[model samples]
Target: MKTYHGSCHCGAVKFRIVSPEITSGVRCNCSICQRKGALMTPHIYSPDDLVIESGEDQLSVYQFGTGVAKHYFCKVCGIYPFHQTMRKAGYYRVNVGCLEGVEPLQLQVEVFDGKRL
Candidate 1:
């Protein structure tokens, strides 16, 4: 697995995800996700696979509905980079677009009916 580095726009929050270069990511049609334009790579890793290299304190979280999914962003830049999964403790859905040098459009996207779930 290749280790990829990512950070918020302002560089306040930085993290790493160990995985193959992504060929696809999950694109949820849920209300909030659609509105925020967040294209996530769901279940890419357990929490153990993600390492916050710096600015842990700069991260903020948002949740709604069941509140099981915890969306994490940089408090300083307001950039959404990842979220904790709803069903799996310590598993994360990462923002592929936020991964350094990743092209969001290049990812083959799978659509999830998150609104219906």
Candidate 2:
């Protein structure tokens, strides 16, 4: 596992999560995802694997569709940094774009058919 530090645009929310190898991230064609244009790295992590370094109160939550995944973003910056995937039995999916010094577009991407739902 590798550690990645992430934060919102305005640096209001900062966090770290352990990811496996991180060769790729998921690009879902779902309505919300398409609108947000976020490259998601849905790493399977136990709740303890994530550490919120600061700005917990600056975050806001959004949910849609089946309301399974709870997307968390910074209220001030409006950046989706991570989400709790209820569809995957309750694991966290961190937004690799928010990670420090990481170029999300350089990673291999697997597309999911979320629009079919």
Query: Highest TM-score among the candidates is held by which one?
Result: 1
Candidate 1: list runs displaced more than 4 Å: none
Q: Model 1 misses residue 99 by how many Å?
A: 0.7
lDDT of 2: 0.84
Candidate 1 lDDT score at position 100: 87
Error of 2 at 59 (Å): 0.6
Q: What does candidate 1 score on TM? A: 0.91
Give all candidates' CA lDDT scores.
Answer: 0.84, 0.84
Model 1 misses residue 77 by how many Å? 1.0
Model 1 Cα displacement at 115 (Å)?
1.3
lDDT of 2 at 94: 81
Clashes of each: 1, 0
Q: Which residue segments of model 2 deviate by more than 4 Å?
A: none
